[model samples]
Target: METIRYGPEPSQLAELTRPSGRPKGVVVVIHGGFWRSRYDLSLGRPLAASLAAEGWAAWNVEYRRVGNGGGWPGTFDDIAAAIDALADVDDLDTGSVLTLGHSAGGHLAVWAAGRARLAGPPWGRPRVAVTGAVSQAGVLDLAAAHDANLGTGAVQDFMGGSRDDRYRLADPAAMIPLDVPVRCIHGTEDDVVPLSQSTGYVERAVRAGADAELTEVAGDHFVLIDPASAAWARTLQILTALG
Candidate 1:
């Protein structure tokens, strides 16, 4: 219900609420726009409002767009700052964190939780430990995405630079080794990010000893955010199971 701004200027956190008398947990929803400055984070408001009505406090977060170095430290830093801000808000349950992101956001969602696993990343472990993740059409493999040239140069901008960045924070395929609880929902008909992203994720997660499930649904990239679509139903079910 209240929009909160945290971190440095230009860097902000946007949120929506529905006042569910008592919240069961906090769900941080990351908006996907290939991390560009033009897209803004307001689009995810509907998703956050929906989750808030379902007895969950939804924190819709935004960070700086891809920096000259691709949005490295800055993007990552903003994510950590926004999640930590939830602690100051009353009724938030720090122990439970359910992060959901679509497309580019998905990559950040998983990365935020497993940042500590990054061999030599400057930032330390994140405080926003994920209880579960519902990634919809996420870019799980940067190497794959880069090869496919997803989101045009938008993804590349978010990533900052080359393969080194992919290894450090871009590739979820490599980070899956930490084995966090993740649920990937992809539209069987999706063309943007494709079901392959989730499929590859399912394979890697299982191989890495993490708990992961891949569920197929009907529709395309946009349907995942459309409440009327089957993709939304799958998302609800996934979060329900996690909660």
Candidate 2:
């Protein structure tokens, strides 16, 4: 595992793990902590390592979260920079990059994939081209999350405001019909992020003519990120199928 810095800030770092032999592709892992500073990139280390062992170059990225110089546009900016930084890496297959995010990270992953259409002063344009994305129990629908007050109003806190233009621009559901294929996997028993988030988003994406699908598993939220969990194995299968 090699720690690479995408920006000067400590939060703008990613752990890169190369496969034992030639990598099949690159997998960008994004951790979920409800977009808070209390949670760091460590949550994604296990998944990155697992992907590396499976012959895929995994890049586990970290970004500024709420309460750590992160809110609204800052958090978005950090994610954009971290993903785009992949262009600087060597010997990695940039053409076939896939992003996997859990929880709030799942939101960012889908959002990052659709950054090309984001409109606002803060969101310019993302240079990284994501070929595919997987959201594991992702908080994909910001408006619904805000209404339901998931994570004690985490959506409001991350957006730094209520449902407004900024919230709409940052929302993965609102930015649907992304060019790439999106697969949303959620545990039916997930209490943290409900199944509606995945189903709702995929419904909208399909209506918008995007290639989106929802896969339901039998587990909870954390199981999606646990390397030893059956959910994790299913996730691996999904990633393998992405090729």
Candidate 3:
């Protein structure tokens, strides 16, 4: 594994891992911490290493979170810069790029894939297009998260507001019909994020004519990211199918 910088800030970095032989593609792993400083990229290191061992180049990205130089546009900006930086990586197939994010990272993964649809001066264009995305126990629906008060007002803290526009911009559910294929996997017993977040987003995405679907697994929130768990096996199955 090698650490590479995508921007000036220390948080704007990613850990790159290459397999023994030619890789199928690159997988961008985004960690979950409810978009807070307390949780860093450490949560994603294990997953990145595992992907590398499975013959995939894994770019585990770290971005500024709430309490740091993150929140709102800053967090969004960091994610955009980190994913785009992969274009500069040598000997890698960016055309087959995929994003796998857990929890809050899941929201960003799906959001980043749909960035091309955003209006204005293109806040940030990914140099390498994202072909597909997987959200593992993600808070996909910002409005639902805010309404349920997940993480004790985490949605408001991350978005910096409770306005409708704020929710619309940050909510992955609202940004449905993304061009790329998106799969959301959630644990049936996940109390932290809830299965509804994934199911709700998939429902909306399908209704909007997006290639989206939801898979329900057994276990709680952490099991989805735990390598030894059945939930993780299901995740790997989905990822391998993508390839």
Candidate 4:
């Protein structure tokens, strides 16, 4: 694993794990911790290592969380920089970049994929585009999550306040028809994040003519991130098929 800095900030870094042979593509692994500072990039390390073993260059990214220097556009900016930084990595196949994010990271993964749709946004244009995405029990619907208070006001904290006009740009659910294929995998028994997050997002995406689908497995929220769990195995299969 090689550590690279996309920005001068301590959190504006990412760990790159490359396969021995030429990589099929790059997979940006974004961790999920309700977008809080307590949850760092470690949550993505295992998935990054696993992707490397499967012949994909894994870019495990770290961005400022709420408690840190991240909130609203700041967090979004870091994600954009980290992904665009892939352009500087030699021998990496930037043509087919995909995203794998769990929970809050899942939201970022899908949101980053749709950055192309944002017009005159604060994050700016995307260089390395996302071709596909896999959301592991992600908080796809910001409004729904906010209304339910799923993360105990996590959505509010992430947005930095109540759901306002900014939600049109910030919420993954609102940024539908991502144009790229997306597969949302959720645990049926997920207590941390309801299964509806993925299901509702997929439903909206499909209705909007995007290639999206939902898969439900039996496990809690964390099972999807556990490499040893069947849920993770299924996630790997989904990612392999997408790749």
Clashes of each: 4, 0, 0, 0
Worst 10 residues of 1 by lDDT: 66-75
Off by over 4 Å in 3: 120-124
Ordering by TM-score: 4, 3, 2, 1
How far out, in Å, is residue 115 in model 1?
Answer: 1.9
**Which 10-residue window of candidate 3 scores lowest in summed lDDT?**
117-126
lDDT of each: 0.75, 0.89, 0.88, 0.91
Candidate 3 lDDT, tens digit per residue, 1-243? 889999999799999999999998889999998999999999998888888888889999999999988998899888888888998888888878889999999999899888777775445446778889999999898888988889999988988877577666667877778999998999999989988899888988888999998899988899988987888888888888886
- Which ranges in model 2 have alpha carbons more than 4 Å from their true place? 119-124
- The residue pairs found clashing in candidate 1 are 1-17, 67-71, 69-160, 70-160
Q: TM-score of the candidate numbered 3?
A: 0.97
> How high is the lDDT of residue 63 in model 2?
93
Candidate 1 vs. true structure, TM-score: 0.91
Q: Residue 21, candidate 2: how far off, in angstroms? A: 1.1
Better of 1 and 2 by TM-score: 2
- Candidate 4, position 171, lDDT: 87
- Model 2 lDDT-worst window of ten: 118-127
In model 3, residue pairs whose N, Cα or C atoms come closer than 3 Å (at least 3 residues apart or on different chains), thus clashing, are: none
Question: What is the RMSD of candidate 4?
Answer: 0.9
Task: Residues 1-243, candidate 1: write the lDDT tens digits.
Answer: 787888546657667574558776778888887777765677678788778777777888878876422275677777777877776776566687888888888887877667667655354555556677778888888787877778886556666556574465656787776546888888888988878888988897888789988988888887888866767877977888887
